[model samples]
Target chain A: MTSLGRGASVALTDLEKSYDRVAAVAGVSLDIRSGEFLTLLGPSGSGKTTTLMMIAGFETPTAGDIAIDGTSVVGMPPYRRNIGMVFQNYALFPHLTVEENIGFPLKQRGMPKPERAKLVGEALELVHLPGYGGRYPRQLSGGQQQRVALARAIVFKPRLLLMDEPLGALDKQLRENLQLEMRRLHADLGITFIYVTHDQEEALTMSDRIAVMNDGLVAQVGSPEDLYDRPSSRFVAAFIGESNFLPATVRGMEDDVVVAECEGAIVRAICPGRPASGDRVLLTTRPERLRFTDGAWSSSAPQNRMNVTVTEAVFAGERCRYMLQAADGTAMVLKEPSSAAIRRRAVGERTEIAWSVADTILV
Target chain B: MNLVQAIAGRVLPTTVVGLILLFLIFPIVVVMVVSFSSATYLTFPPPAFDLRWYKAYFGNEDWLRPTWLSIWVAAAVVILSTLLGTLAALGIARLPPALRVVASGLILSPLIVPVIVVAIGIYYAFSRYGLVGTPVALVLAHTCLAVPFVVTSVSASLSGIDPRLQQASLSLGATPIGTFFQVTLPLIRPGVLVGALFAFITSFDELVVSLFLSGSGAVTLPRRMWDDLRFAIDPTIAAVSTLTIVLTVALMGCAHLLRKRAT
Candidate 1:
């Protein structure tokens, strides 16, 4: 789905941003590959948007260097940066028509009228809003306006695009539709996309790489699978997706797996020689990874097993979610597909929760 | 509700508003009607209606000169105040809250101070420079009174424009100055126009400063009218007043239309 467009490689080294003596983005360093869709994912005030702003040249970095295609652009002004940006509010010029808005960058570059009009028409077609060139932004719907903004940003064919929560204002269904469209556009343009969003799910769905930020620093940067399956910190594990974290004490090691005692239950995780015996760690596992022992092909020797009392059982269409409390009152959720040959556990029922070592990780 | 109480509830406000309107418009109406009278002296409820007074106002050179002087002075004042006020508003829009407050108060001080005090101060300053009776002095003095209205109008318009629109323009490869011209200037035109109108009317109707600054060649309409009031109570003065009122009303209507179009 990659488009025929050039992309630039961006690298930030030891970036530090502070406002009024308070650090907004502190010492962030990341390399963005050409044509890669990298998302800065974090909650509000977590410096993700600030980092995007810094990259867009709208915010001056107090310390550090940003290089585009191996050239330092630390002092370059925004107008000279040759980068496209879409603001959260869409920021379409209300006074200009759609064609004029898309043609603005070309006009600024002193492009001739004929060529500019052709490019604007192509941009309109690219955003699937052909014949909408004559209309003003106020005459368009929210979603259509958002598409126009996107079209305007890309019309000049900049090497890099920066978006700050571009779809945060749309409703859920439209947001989802646009999320797919954005991913497709990223692929089609083949331009490096540095997207910023507080929604982790959008980042996971669209980005080739996700930079999970906390406070003012990046907690982890990895692919979606890597971030989900092997989070480096507790913040990444909790922020990326749902996970039940249990305090564990390392017990023993066998091959690549480390055995640990979690509360009153024995747990095991696939470890690469990090946790030594007697070391404290947090054992985390996804709810869907756990299973009820009686329904599943019973594992004669599972790595982890705990006796739990079913506190609440909910049938959530696609999956049956069971909220269970272990013997030590540590709550855990076990999700099993409704379509699978699984027995549903009722509330207040006794059960045994089992999971293999491959499904858990110690952070 | 009973008929009397309901009628009173509605008719009371209507009657009060009608009385206030009558009170406010009565003098202007009387002046308009008296201006049309054929009598040579100022007399209401004349015996016959004639255009002789309007003819006298147009045919006379002294009255015509002052009218031309007022128009030119008001035009010059409008240009000066609009320029200074728009620039001042732009500067104030970017200033921090505390400094902006101080700046605004300083700029609007002329409006808050008594007109007579301002006029006396200007007269003193202009006399020192031998500019007491110059049109430039009159224009400068009028500009000081009119700038605050321009500032307030432009400031309101500037606030209405989203700051993000400027940021968006910058992001789209327009420089700050370019953004101001391309994005900001057009959006704030209504405010600037309103300010210009205010400056125009302020200079046209100004009497306090004009009384001190206007001389033989630079006499404004208001100053000439004051002279006529002191010397002769002619029906031509009434005709001039009717014309001034008409011009002011037409200008206000234009301002209203401009504001409506802008929104």
Candidate 2:
């Protein structure tokens, strides 16, 4: 089998789609680099799948243009676009044996018999199913069938590959296994991949870049660390992982840091976007960022501490989560690695929580 | 338990199913017995066994002519109805749900309308154009009756195929027509075969429409059989019935084989 050439870069300019009066994807513009594994991550009905369909050319944008490798392909049909897609259901042709299914694209292009057979065998080997060519899709397990689908999609050596939740139907263990395989395939093939999924952990684990979508619009697009550490919106902060949002007002700016007043206390944090003084904002921090003061409340600086009552504690083997309520009744959860010294505090016992100023974010 | 009690435990459902089976098979068995009878008139369990009626059925021009006519007419109906019904099913499957339901009901109206009523209506319409009793008229009428079966069967098969298969084929660089031929058609082969079988059988065994529409020019097998029953108790008609039973069983076996291969 021939290796895929240098991957195609895609540019979606002001892409939008609507079904009757309902907007499925609303005004999305994204630049995808060649050979990058970009994931469109979101909850259900969040327009991620629609965006992928638009890129695959199955969907015609209601208003906008799409270009592949600097050439506009707005009205082009999917077949002529030369892209590979793996559907959520796998969509392996049930009538064809595994070899025929993997060689379908080549067969359509009228590849000769001997060449086609050689390529089909090579494609099967790529998916680690070397001897499964004669078996029908129904005879194989779900994971094996999925691998066949992957083999079929990539056997044509298309410039781009799009996957719509390809492992959504498999069990957790199998899904994780396939996720690693997919990463290896992407690396080996070195093709642009635009994957759509609602599973945040899968997106975080496999993607070179992620575009977290919300309500038909892209909320944020960045690397996994960029999104986790510096989410630009409340929706991104909450959707990517767990977070605590505290209401605050911007007080002043100091170089890269912004001082904010939160819950009758002054908190200093790094803000990517500057806001005017007295502007209402949210102070966001991750659950793991918070730490127990170890009863030395007055030893630390006064501005970054909160006195709270422990309401509930859950022990989860390696880590413990403590639910606490501040003096004004704002609830927050703190997570720390489990240890012999850590014990469930008595219900209603007052405690102090603190975090580094660098970890706090003003959104 | 005693023998009576043990038997009683199974007797109720077993007896019910047995009666139903007997009710269905008894007439066919009697027809087969009479077809081999040595007697001159229709009778059950003749004193001797022979193939006299079978020989008569094959040798007689009146019976042989109509039998060939019915076979050709049913073949024509199968081809015409399968083509029309498969196209209609594909088109209807793509329509919006509300319109699809309405279109399906309209297409299937012949099955819901009384057969005699449809026959009379067709007779009235065809009589005006001097088309009554012609092979074309009969084939058209039977197509109307059989298209619904084809539609329902093919529609069911089309629905069973995941729509994504077509999308995947296109995404893998197959054109729309290629996808339909290579992916959609093979997946729906069993349904189409079953539908064609139903169309063929419906046209072949139809009696009421032929009774209303058949002239001396287009005497179907059932029309000739009806005439024979009215004029005389010919055991040759029994042989015809037996042949039809065998044909139907063979057709069913073919359809079953198709379904098995599809899965």
- Say which candidate scores most in lDDT: 2
The list of candidate 1 runs beyond 4 A from truth reads A1-5, A299-303, A339-342, B1-9
lDDT of each: 0.90, 0.91
Residue-level lDDT of model 2, residues A263-302, one tens digit each, is 7778888788879999998889999988888666443432
Residues B1-263, candidate 2: write the lDDT tens digits: 78788678788779989999999999899999889999998888876899999999999999999999999999999999999999999999999999999999999999999999999999999999998879999999999999999999999899999989999999888999999999999989899999999999999999999988888899999999999999987789899999999999999899888877766
TM-score of chain B of each: 0.98, 0.96
DockQ for all models: 0.74, 0.84
Clashing pairs in 2: none
User: How far is A56's C-alpha from truth in model 2 (Å)?
Assistant: 1.6
TM-score of each: 0.95, 0.93
Each model's RMSD to truth, in Å?
Answer: 2.6, 3.2
